[model samples]
Target: MVSQVVWAQVRSKAGRLVERPVRELRGERLEEYEAVWQPPRYQGRRAIATWWRPADRARHVGCAHLGALGAAVSLEADRDVVAFASWPMRLHWADDAGGYVPDFFVRLADGRVRLLVCRPAGGSPQRWEAAAELLEAAGKQADWQVHVHEGTADPVVFSNLQRLSRWRHTRLADADTARVLRKVFAEPQPLAVGVRESGLPELPTVAKAHHLIWTRKLLIDWSSPYMPHRSLVWAPEGVV
Candidate 1:
């Protein structure tokens, strides 16, 4: 509660320096984008994607880039981000040469704007810290909360999450099959064993499990590789 009051005070201080949304730009930056590059590119891949969130996700783009690291970052965005954009936001200061456009503009669960830059371990460039300082100052002036994401999660965990994310949209068509799988998962055990002992058709049973994991009705160790023969999962409310 104290933190909420503090944030409110900060927002009050910001006092509408800029009226536009964070993702939109006016004047010089818009002109350069419209008349010059047309679209931003990272490793020949223009930043674009439909977000995973259900509320008007189709109309909102979530990220942009074309590389392995970019792909990993995009996955993290879909799984963990509340909302985001790729190179669509910029911040300019009066004395600076020009505006600064970071790699990503992320809105986290806490209502803080994160200027995310994905870089290799031990390879951070000096410009990032400079931009971070500038953006922080801008936020402070406006009484908005801003954060800089300079580090990444564990690679193994990232890869594991990526693999499981493939099943995020999976669903089961057969009601009976889904029921059986739910019963099987009600008691935590290896999925392969559940399929075998339940005497349900292996193919269909496994498909329903994918849906469960996707919906988070079934929880697994997202930080480790999914062991098809041995990952443990169960229903919510400490059922496992």
Candidate 2:
């Protein structure tokens, strides 16, 4: 038996409503949907709506809750994620029996689109399984990837990402300092040593190093807790 095709309802940046079959969603039309779809405001008492501005994107991405915010943080730090938006569209079955709004729509460096759903830690996964399956089916029709983020498993990694995110702004980047730091860590070295070796002002150099790490120009063991003086830092592959 042939499964029913899914439908997508999207709002343009100019506030226009568009509805179409998921298979027909591509090219310019898909770009329009990703560029302008805004997430509905959160009204519940528990989770607060928030906004996050990533260095890679010009506009702030709205997040419905902290778990979504965390997912955004991880996306910002990902080198492959070229762009993303929140709640970019709604999906429904052919008969419109039910619908879902995904947490994020991501554009990868290789030109792939992804739909992400965030379920915070401690939330029951079973509750979202059915909806996720539906979203997955819709995504498959649209040739987009689908995933559900269940919060970070490692508190230390989450804490590290949160700390590094503070330095994610482009203002902290310095080409000369980055070059020097990358050279200093061509081999594995302590975070303090590389920063000191940059031969720049101590405070500014430290911030730049953290920024480079956040951008993945300088690599660190994400599984390890970040430390100012002790954590090992190194250049990524292909960096001399």
Candidate 3:
């Protein structure tokens, strides 16, 4: 009989598992596209607009936490459950496809797909709410999962989460990236009296966060970080 231990050990290492070939995202051939169905809407990159200068640090730290958790989490702060392909995953649904290319799209080894939506602290709550509504409607039809997160310094808005289930708030230890993002994600308002009473440090911009109306955490499997971007399935180049 084949030794299960050997097989398991081999699979644990990158480039050792015998599996299906991975595809990359390149063009317009995503599993789904907004232009084909709905009119696009957007004026700028959501991350830069939302978190502004600190967006990259916010995303890097978030992805690092996700990586440490050993889940298949990709980065995206917008769109449906489809994975964002990049560091600061901002979701976009364009009616005409006349904006920046998507940040990144991820395809895990297990074949699960999700979209990432990054929301900055102190953005137009209206837009976030509108996007949440669209995601809820689209989720039922597309059978996708959506994950939303706020930059560390931003407040996690809880206004429209009544419809979601199993929601809980948890905080992770701040990392280097979180430290760098402090200036951008930090809020201008004073810390709540309660927060001060608890003896925590004054909140930084990286301290604020909001939950996107999503079912579960967005994921990207990074067991094999050394693998070339082209080796992965669902790369940007492969999308079209």
Winning candidate number (TM-score) = 2
The CA lDDT at 191 in model 1 is 79
Best by lDDT: 2
Q: What is the clash count for each candidate, in the order shown?
A: 2, 0, 65
Off by over 4 Å in 3: 1-104, 152-240
What C-alpha lDDT, on a 0 to 100 scale, does residue 16 get in candidate 1? 26
TM-score, each model?
0.59, 0.83, 0.27
lDDT of 2 by residue, 103-135 (tens): 888888989888888855566677467577677
**Sort by lDDT, top down from the best:** 2, 1, 3
- Per residue, candidate 1 scores C-alpha lDDT tens digits across 1-240 of 111111110011233223233222211122112111123445755445333322223333333333324443443435465655544445555444355655444565655555555432343577666656666655554344454444335777566655555555434545566666677778778878888877987886787777667656666777767787888876566433
> Measured by TM-score, how close is model 1 to the native structure?
0.59
| CA lDDT of every candidate | 0.51, 0.79, 0.28
Tens digit of lDDT per residue, candidate 3, span 82-169?
3323332222233312211222234434455543444434668976675565544333333434555443232222212221211222
Question: Clashing pairs in model 1?
Answer: 14-142, 47-64
Question: How big is the positional error of residue 40 in model 3, measured in Å on the Cα after superposition?
Answer: 15
- Decide which is better by lDDT, 1 or 2: 2
For model 2 the local lDDT of residue 92 reads 77
Task: Candidate 2: count the clashes.
Answer: 0
